[model samples]
Target: MSEKMEVDTPTTAATEEKKAEHVTPSASGESAAEHPDMKLAQAIHKAVLMSSNKIPMDTAHIDTLKADLIKMSNPSLIESLASPLQWDLSTVDIAGMKTANETTLNELEEKVKEAQENAGDMEVLEARIAVAQFAAKSMSKKEALAMYQLVLDLPKLSSGKQMDALMEQSRVCSFYSDTLKNKDYIAKISKLAEESGDWDRRNRLKVYTALQNILTRDMKTAASLLIDCIATFSCTELCSYPNFILYTMMTNILYLPRTDLKAKIIDGSEILSVKDDVMPVFTLVKCLYDCDYKGYLQAMVEVESVLLADRFLFPHAGYIMRELHVLGYKQFLDSYKSVTLTSMAQSFGVSVDFLDVQLSRFIAAGRLTAKIDKFGGVVETNRPDLKNAQYRDMIQQGDLLLNRIQKLARVVDV
Candidate 1:
């Protein structure tokens, strides 16, 4: 054994502290079956060897070791140290050696990070799979769609499984008429419907899915399918768009002016005359075109269960639908706040000056209150107590406009 060896180097404070705690016992008590003088000699020898070389032992570490050694009584450790075994310092040197380029190691470390990220994605995929399975088993199309979306997002997921889950969600959602957030899912199902070759189901699904795609503003997909879907199926029972569909899509002047679908509106005018069932939808459509916010909101209330999907008139119409459906009073307040003279004028498709004059007449007749702002504009507040008498007189006089509303009601296609 060498009298002095520079074998160990401290890399960290904790390592240095551990070395001090374990080092002194190996040095001071280096012999057993020896007299006090011999033990003292061994301690001195260790002290000389340790002091001869600057090994960087911390004083704080040394003091801690000294205190610990006072309590421990393990003599065999001293005997073994007296005839100290040779340490394979080669192994320690190998451990201490590192790559020259810290950058290269950092790059390798980044690869390891990427692998961990992939592993996390795999876990997410697994979770999605589990959720999908649960949703399918429970027949919860909405929940399944949510899970399928997660599965579709993972780039590494098996395409076969992704497609399978997607199809499953699509089938269930179509059957239940559940809405999905992803356009791809809708497209996939529409294609499936086309391939399956069921005329009624396929055509309906195609139109519904196309509408869903439209709801997301994927106009290219919608345009691609609209003409084909309309041609493929008759709209007699299902009311597929630009024809029998009495929902909010045709409620705008933009829809009315479309030449390709103009005859459908004229047909709708006829449909209005047949049994008067479509009145609610026609009225809503008119309100939408007129931007009669309050009237539209009020009309929504007369319909039972606004939560019913078919009754959900607007496709992604936002708070306009939500407040009217779930919080009517709040929507009422918002409508009142949004009202202005220009709004009323635009609603009637007339000049602001003309509307103001009409409003002033109503105010003078005590049928409405003319709230004139300092900036020179008026808001009409209809008073039922005063207006009821006028409404009765109008009813008796058989006002042509009121008669038209009644006639529209007679042809209302519910």
Candidate 2:
């Protein structure tokens, strides 16, 4: 009986060992479930399920929820969270809204082509057309332009509708740099703005045109238009750059005479709120205002790479630098009819030859009616008599007109 029990014990022990092996896997799984990463994943899962029960009605919240889920740093788990959010009933409702928007878009297609013989729907049509145009613009320019043309060609739009369409078209045309197209669009929009009699709309359109010119790096036109815009706009309008149009206007205007816009300019608080790259610009503006030539030059040098990399300011940057030189000389010479070149150079902290070259440019451009008395080493200002200057200008213009008339007559004779 003892021998039989010993043999049975070996078989029982082997069976017990087999059971231990099977239970070890289940024990290891339990240990893994206690791991920090696993615990975190489970916590995230519970959070998501809770959130799903009280999901936000707003679609914008969906992005926030997705962002929260991605923070878990577990690819397998992220996939699980992503899958549920993808087809969540809330998102499904968004798809329904999109379908309804598509139907509105189709109706807009017909409404744009035919005048609703009903005046009642005209206001609603305008609103719907605006929404449709924005959608089409995002999808394709060709489609947007067709809609724009339909609105523009409409013979009898309300001043309000015309203003809306013109503003939209002006803004859209700015995406392209075609001179002819921009000019044509500007002409049409300007006409519409004029007929609307809304001074603010006209001013805003000028600013829009100026911004397009800036994007094209046509600084002269941009500057001219911006100056006109500044005149038309209130001090409040020029204070901050809420739009690219305003931003370019304000930054570039810093280089111009600021006597009129002193209070209207962006301040230190405003500069701090802007980009680090723009800090150099504000610094340059300060240097300019303080008449700190050396500081201004250094600021420009510090930002030269930035200027070249920037599309709007790059083309005119070198010109602005030269303008600084001219401005320094002009301010220093504002009191002097004639001063020794060396003395002027010393006052402005520049070399005699350098000063001469800069002054020569101003003289040649007729900006400064002055002559370099090389022998006397003095710059003599040619103070023109106002009446005589006007007389000379009139004669020069008359001569140009006469020459054009003669050429036309000669062509006619032939």
Candidate 3:
């Protein structure tokens, strides 16, 4: 117990705040009687001593005990923490998958309850505890939400726990295509993260917020937030080279380019290098940036697996597909006044019939700015006069100037 003691500091305090969330709840909701002073030590020993043969190693709460156990020279305890994240004991026996998982889940639930009881009411463990329980049970969306909400509602959940709960909720809602619910949960999490003074979490929360905003009609806001996230995060030393960061950087530029961020993306390349797995995503962005329609389509096919596996990224990936297709069509229509559908298909790497349908969608959406002649198999581009384009640019610049001046006036008054 003496060796288990750590000096209490603000950082350690923050981490320990939700330490209770790792435990599964008891059926009776009553914790075993334990002395307050020895609770954390007891919980650590119990968790170590438990039969973890069937327990998945990805338990979030287990991370807290990692350093201490290592200091105590506990190799078996460390090894027990290294199983596949989604692996479950129940999945082993086909006949008893649910029953096995449920039994293990029940045991975890009892352990968590006792741990929390020993640790005291102020234990901030909802986030870790909720995640552990949810993973163990592998419950349906309805059941997960109900159980998770109960855990979330517990008193004294630390900011980290709250964010975890929100993130877990976000994942659940994402699976069900519950866009509105995802938006609400992320929005709440964003605010909580800000208040918690966890700068890293707050920055990452921007990604989630941007994702949900994209699901809604607020694309402009989403783009802005993504740009900010990419710029802020990429420039940092904290896990900056993740595939998602690069994707965000590229996606923002796909629809709206930010001058400041584009430079950061290039510089951060040296510090936070891209992984090989994310190469296709990078290529896709390059294609879009370079106006290489052929490459863009190829890169899209290449990154299909990455797009499907990433949850936060999964939803926005469609935008990339749709926008890139639109951009390709926009580019394809650029050099020709009229081109046969067959020629267009060959250039863009698709069937003539598919191009015809895709072109029609582009046309109907008012994106193509051209007409598809079905009989002739010709897709024509409608180019505006240079004089008209120049005039429109003049008006747009004037509007921007006027808005800036108005904003400046308000600042002056303040």
- Estimate the Cα RMSD of every predicted model relative to the unseen true structure: 34.1, 28.0, 14.0
- Superposition error at 110 for model 2 (Å): 8.9
Error of 2 at 400 (Å): 11
Instruction: List candidate 2 segments past 4 Å from native.
Output: 1-140, 153-156, 197-200, 212-258, 261-285, 300-310, 318-320, 340-353, 372-382, 385-414
List TM-score per model, in order: 0.30, 0.52, 0.52
Candidate 3: global Cα-lDDT?
A: 0.56
Q: Candidate 2 has what TM-score?
A: 0.52
Tens digits of per-residue lDDT, candidate 2, 188-257, equal 7677554342445556666667766665656667767765654344312212242333344334553556
lDDT of 1 by residue, 79-181 (tens): 2223322222332222122222234335544553554466565554545555454444332345446755755665644333343445455544433334553
Clashes of each: 11, 0, 7
**Top TM-score model:** 3
What overall lDDT, based on C-alpha atoms, would model 2 receive against the true structure? 0.52
- Report how far residue 293 has shifted in candidate 2, in Å: 2.7
Q: Which number leads on lDDT? A: 3
Ranking by TM-score: 3, 2, 1
Error of 2 at 266 (Å): 8.2
Cα misplacement distance, residue 222 of candidate 2 (Å) = 5.5
Q: Which lDDT values do the candidates have, in the order given?
A: 0.42, 0.52, 0.56
